[model samples]
Target: MVSTAAFLRRAFACAAFALVSAAHADLKVGIDLSSTGPAAVIGITSKNAIQMWPATIAGQKAQYIVLDDGTDPGKAVANIRKLIDEDHVDVIVGPNITPAALAALDPVAASQTPMITLIGSASVVEPQEGKRVWAFKMAQTDGAMADVMTRYMANHGVKTVAFIGFADSYGDSWLNEFKRFAELRHIRLVATERFNRNDASVTGQVLKLIAAKPDAVLVAGAGTPAALPQRTLVERGFKGPIYQTHGIATPEFIRLGGKEVEGTLFPTQPVVVARTLPADHPAKKAALAFVTAYEDKYGPGSVTQFAGDAAGVYPRLEDAVARALKKAQPGTVQFRVALREELEHAHELVVPNGVVNTSAKDHVGLDQRASVMGAIRGGKFVFISE
Candidate 1:
């Protein structure tokens, strides 16, 4: 119905508009991690997983801006402010440790940016109060880990246990859950102690623990630093069974603890032992898919459970963003708020870590099926069954 010149002119304008829309439509995600501090190993693995995520999410271009928080809570809070105020990121992920993640709650809620934390502290998102409404968690809860550990100890005739962990929130959460479950399992708590994550030694604490002569010991800490207490116990020639929380599932922890960590038991997400999981396991298929993508890049046996936790954010974000786009587009305050609401709507989403089904009442969303008992054997993680 139009002349050649008119049709050509109209087509050019339509193409230009499409290009402009594409340029401004990227989903911006900010990552604050402890890349240079004590939790560097965890941060590095998480960053690696983020780098491997698909360039596009739910048909929209995705852009990620990663910042190092150095594992400091103050730095983590500052990083969240910058991400929200300057970068205008719709969602923020991580600051590997529990303290950093907890410290970030204020800034995240102020900007209405959805935060997905990769820490084991269930309190980070529990109660789902004012600020917590903006936060979600990826790691399995300490309660879930404690339940598995206590059951394992009870079945193994561990009548009494000693507990030593970081003098921070991670340790507090673990101790509380372990105590609750241990009492129910009829296990006696003989001694309780704490140490700083960066303490040069835990000799004094270890001595007190050995004096109690408990049947077993539980170290509630994360990353390579968690190895200090258990390694010190072995050095002290205390030989009852030793257990750790899921936080120490990384290879760096095993390497740092060396032979001292052998036979050490813990509760971890099935992704850590995905290859050994039964074909019918709900998490097996998704976990194996991530393993293939990750190992293909980082080499066989280089994949860590931390990477699985980080990789989980991508699919969850993708699923939520897809639904959110129906109501809002990226790059605006409305988009950020909509993303937060949509994230809470995540239901039955399978990830390498677990099945996610977040809601107003529960943010972590993982159940007992998310945890499987594991032990460090011959410098590798192996699944343990009843």
Candidate 2:
């Protein structure tokens, strides 16, 4: 995780440049999010999420370049460099995947370009002890998500738990985390299963886990494919409580699994469930309003709230870039430096998530409340503290 303090310190170490003359001034921003191919399903949602927010909110013209990452890290790094060195973009909005986000971390921070991304790995923030200020997640982390799950499990008397993971970067990361936290929290991890992302049948694994009879099963893959076992259990009439990471708990699973996913409980940010937050809570309100607008723009009946994670991060990415631009003195170096500096805001402000107290000391621009327990109710996500 990027420690806020160390990142801020390094951000200051990367000095700013003198600005170019005021003539051809246009705030050109570059976006390297997944916009096409398999990732587009998420990229388009995030793209709209970024655009829906008022651009000038952070003080910058919304001139942008959205690139298709093709879900490749090397390509993401190359594109990000081009945007900074060749395109001379004032800031950046993305490269959503954590591995892809990892590829660009050193490049953007070393180049001193302030950028935000939809990453879930803590390595991006800490990046080997020193802080990489320019990198951050528009979404929450898997470890933190694990923390919530463990706490919930402990609270609910769920002692023996099973984990079904995709064997991908996200799944592996969290599976390891869940084991570690399980030990710490005294929760016995009864069984574990892994499946390929392309596997259409997880019946064998589901049967294996069913035999284990875990108090609860946690699914950690990315899409409907990961929800296979969760769905199959229902087919076999095995209906113990089911838990999952935010990724697989989409409406697509509901449409794909039909009744199987109906009662599956998943951990997700509460922002999707509320139409507006309580008047006293701005973040809650922001999440509700954002979800409402998103549903209005693209009918919710057919969409999954988890997809919104992609959409929701872009604007946050843009805002950081905009701030960096306004404070950047001149030239690529200075602007990049400013981008790095302005992006560190846990001390002064809180964005959509709550208590985001990141700084040079903390690189994880997140807090505990960024995650909440959610369930699919009547075919839609319903957030409940329980």
Candidate 3:
């Protein structure tokens, strides 16, 4: 019943440990995030980040077993099965995206595998609290994002929200939660529109919504892929405020839309420049260290601090994986399930950004309890956790 990924991982780790027993301990990690089709960048970042962990840990490298889920849940299941049954992975970190995350969640959960995911879907973990017991999120949820944006807007006395989301689950999920959160806060619900993830422009939608005069537009699109709306806002000359969900690419938005993308903002992991950042910063010097380390490992121009987190989260997950490995008793499975109790609602350790206080009762690592807010200033992220 062990996952092929887990199986492969064990074999690889054992062989690696045997080969390098003196100065380093061996670990086998399975990456099923992206190895397949177009999502290669995500997979590459994920794998590279995970690989960098052991590189940074003790100059010891873990053997990695990688597979791409191909954006198909079925393919995802098959790939996970291969990793579980074939690779014998000790624990699994990701399949990325909602569908793949969901596809592998149950199967891996049943196998008592520990899965650290960044997927924001609340349902993936069920019960929202202690559902799978083996699952954890390094990524914040849509509701967490909604709460941040809505509360900020409410505090600022802004109302009338028009949703400019993609026609997909990720977007739709945010749209639903945003509306729900907005309603709870007495914010007016205006209109909603969709855009293509491929090439269709959101300029028309921005104009249409601008004509409606919503106080602010809420956007939901893929990382860097959702730069369309900001571009739209500029081309059409809408002066209203813009709010973004977590996924949009800040650098791409800025690069593509220039001044229009300047003020656009969303929730993201904290990034600070040590020298320039305030000493009171919660993310502090370590956050800046992550950026420097990431650049050193990946080479310059690999990813902006915006999506740098899109990739930076991997090391955080690696810490969770290593932590799981330690607790994996001699007889215990040491799979995702065991790690779930330790990771999901059990611990609060600093990853790249801030401390992730997750537990069995709280699945999202941000603690469903606190929200971290940041604004892009002069091209850098400034924490406003107030």
lDDT of each: 0.83, 0.64, 0.59
Query: Mind giving the per-residue lDDT tens digits that candidate 2 earns over 1-386?
Result: 21223222222232332222133445666788766544455565566555444333245434556677876778888999998888787666677666777778777766666666765556566542443666655567778888887888888888898888876666778798889888888989888889876677888888888899888888877656656777777776676888877665445667776777887777776455554234554356445545555566667653344345544444344445656656654345776676566556534233444435556656556666577777777877776665
Deviation in Å, model 2, residue 368 alpha carbon = 2.5
Assess every candidate by TM-score: 0.92, 0.82, 0.78
Root-mean-square deviation of candidate 1: 8.3
Best by lDDT: 1
The candidate scoring highest on TM-score is: 1
Q: 1-386, model 1: which lDDT tens digit per residue?
A: 10122211222122111211233547888889888888888888988877766556777877778889988999999998998898788899997889988889889888788899988898888878999998998988889889988888888899999999999999999999999999999999999999897899999999999999999999988889899999899999999999998888777887788999999998889778888776777888777777766776777777778888988887778778988998888887788888888888877777787788878788888887688888888788878884
Q: Model 3 over residues 1-386: C-alpha lDDT tens digits?
A: 11122211222132112211223224444556654454444455555545443332213255556677765668888877776776666556677666677777776766666666656566576565343666656666788878887888888778787778777677778888888899999999787888755556666677788888888877887555576787777678777777776665334445555566667666654542333455764544455555555556566535433333334344444545555656653124654444455455334454444556665666665643234555556654445542
Q: How many collisions per candidate?
A: 0, 27, 32
Ranking of candidates on lDDT, top first: 1, 2, 3
By summed lDDT, which 10 consecutive residues of candidate 1 come out lowest?
A: 11-20
